[model samples]
Target: MDGLPMGRRAFSSTSPSFRATARVGVAATGVALALLLVVAASGCEPVPDGTPYDLVLAEGQVMDPESGLDAVRWVGIRDGRIATISQIPLAGADTLDAAGLVVGPGYIDLHAHGQDEENHRLFALNGVTTALEMEVGTAEVDEWYREREGQARLNHGVSVGHLGVRIAFYDDPSDFLPSGPGGYAVATDEELDTIRSHVRRGLEEGALGVGMGIQYTPGATRWEVLEVFREAATHQAPVFAHVRGFGVEEPGGSVEAFLEVMGAAALTGAPLHIAHLNSMSLEETPRTLQMFEEALERGLDISAEAYPYSAGLTSIQSALLDRYETAPDTALERLQWAATGEWLDRESFNRYREEGGAVVLHLNTPEMEALAIEHPFTAIASDGRIRDGVGHPRTAGTYARVLGHYVRERGKLSLMDALRKMALIPAERLQEWSPDFRDRGRVREGAWADLAVFDPETVEDRATYAEPALPAVGFHHVLVNGIPVVRDGGVVEGVAPGTGIRAGSWSPGS
Candidate 1:
């Protein structure tokens, strides 16, 4: 409490001196009455005694990128919102001494694929408060929200996915994404109408937006994709897309895919988001980002995001992998089996393709990943999914990796810039569709008290591709709606304070 500004102290009614003064005033009412009348005329109100908050994070380096605030301060929380931020010490029922820690808004992962309890626990340990499946979203928004109502560890939501709709219509027995006939076959006119109806219904039922994985559904015609964009435009919702192709190999390259989505945004006037631009564009990332900048300057609402790792993950049965079958030996060398840590040759690639599983493609280089991360317009997202405790390291490590490697160690990005990408940018992207997002992703008074406190020098991601389920290291405290789900570097047992996030309506509980 040293070097802290003093707040107005409340008079102690129980003190012996105060009692003596009261007795004297009662004995000399004439003089005391005049003094009391003068005091009342001054219009000063008495301060009430006791702690003012339920929780206080004291003396932390509070950083809020949205407000451009970065300094040591005290944060007071009461009834699930930030009540005050002060230069003085605050009294509370509980005080966490965070003298050397960085207090910032909790990270929001917009393209998270893992929306279950196990992954939520890991995400909390890494300081993420909201995780949404906006790339390959749910088929039934109602059922998805219902299932995770009181069971989630962090805020969760989904968009209505074109791939999920395709699977549902074709009756494909795929869990994570569509494959086989649903992924490869073009829809008939009746089926297309049914898809449109489902998309519209999902919007009505409170989906965040429309999700389309054009690369996964290669058979979806340009006209069909545009119709989906138009449906989203009708509701004024954004479209999150994994565009049609990958790499810089002309004709049907990543540039063409970027143009296709940008054109849809221009034609339909719907906001568009490109998923994993680094992995999609590869060596052409610089040129691709230039195109995005140009489109943005032209008044088109287009944005892009990327993960920190050099590799990307997907099902072995996906169309992108099928295209790689005819690719060169170098392409096969880039394929890393998820179950085992071995890089694939042509023989191993064929074997895994037949067996059907997830694979990590080492398609992007470190330089390319850095380029995407350093871009001012690009946001950060973990296109991560976890199943049976075996998945990509991005599931547990994306945000921490950005903080640790990009900001702390390499100095490629400043701390404020990294935080903006992880938290503020993602929240801003979704706030138009969901008003609940307006209160998140900031460490300011009156904002929702979802925050992360960590040691700037020590934060690091411990998860690796070989052992992908390990939680991160330096998140000391994480709060959701002013409730601690993580404290002292571990998850607090029996505390599930997270609520479901929905569009066009506030969630029922914090």
Candidate 2:
């Protein structure tokens, strides 16, 4: 209730004939009044005075990276949208004292693999409002969206995944990624047509985009990948891809794999998003970033994301680790069994490969990871997943780790820039394809009232590799669809305000 009031500019006086100046002033006032009336008729009028807002966050350091707003302000939410942003206080049905806290747009994770209740809670606790499974998305796109509607804690969506379609086609026993014939069996021309049809159907069902895990489906030919890209292009859908291979080892290395997909995007004119640029490139992260920058300069619709961590996680049975059968002990020791947090030897690696479980690979260096995270163009995303408290730490820790360690502790990037990477960049990447995202990722009036309020000095990730489920600390409040899912550092009980996000054109079950 203690702040400066909003003010309007005052008209200046000049030397002129009194009658002429009076006439000009009166005419100007008439035009302005006409314009104001027109605006009010068009439903652009300001909120009526003395009418209480649904919710108000008072005296927070409001930061909107898009508009470069960094000052204390009061925010009023009404009907799940930000209705007022005032320099002074606002009255509301419910009010939160946000003094000394940073109120920014809730983070958006473009590569989230955790969409279940457990992970959604973690994401909300960590200040993420929308967590999308874009890397390896669902095969039954409509069913996937339907299952989460009104049940999820955070906004959710999925792509129509190439990996899932291939696995389903081959009847592969693996659930998440291809491990058997799906990985090794090549598709015939007719089979390729069937795959393209499924991709097209998913788009028609309102999938976020085409999700491709080419590395997991090794048998998918270059031509097959291109045809899928073409299908996505026809729908004006972007392709979120895990390139075909990893490492800088020559021949079937990261360079070759990246070029293959880059070529696909170029040939078909499909927008491309490179998933987890840090993990996929490892030591070659800088080089890959350069390639991405150059491609952007050449008018390619390309973007990349990275989590703030030095390790990666995946199923031991994935085709990505097929060479581990012949790999030396040195290479095998880099893996840590996610179930028990024990380092793996050749014997343990082989045993886990047969047993089929998640394995954490200590593959990247801190320096290389920092390079990707610190890049201006790279968005922050948690390519994260966990089940029953057993998985990598990135799922629970990514955003906070970036804020606490990268921005606050190390001074790697400004707070605004960090928020931009976490919120705005990811939203912009998908807004072109999905109308659900157009007003997201900002703190402006009329934007969605999805917000994260946190104590900048105290916020930090508590989740560790050994204890992966530990929720982050110092998030004072998180709101989804203008409802508080987290308040005063704890999750609000029994609330499910999240809704399914899809492409603009498709309706439910259409």
Which candidate has the highest TM-score of all? 2
- What total of clashing residue pairs does each candidate reach? 0, 0
Poorest stretch of ten by lDDT in candidate 2: 3-12
Q: Candidate 1: what lDDT?
A: 0.82
Off by over 4 Å in 1: 1-51, 505-510
Work out candidate 2's RMSD over C-alphas. Answer: 9.0
How many residue pairs of model 1 clash at the backbone? Answer: 0
State the lDDT of candidate 1 residue by residue for 335-388, as single tens digits. Answer: 889988889988888888888899988888999899998898899998877788
Residue 447 of model 2, lDDT score: 91
The numbered model that scores best in lDDT is 2
Per-residue lDDT of candidate 2, residues 426-510 (tens digit)? 9999998997787899998899999999877678999999999999998999999899999998999899988789998887557
- Give residue 86's error in model 1 in angstroms: 1.2
Task: Please give the CA lDDT of all the candidate structures.
Answer: 0.82, 0.85
Off by over 4 Å in 2: 1-49
State the displacement of the C-alpha of residue 151, model 1, in Å, after optimal TM-score superposition.
1.3
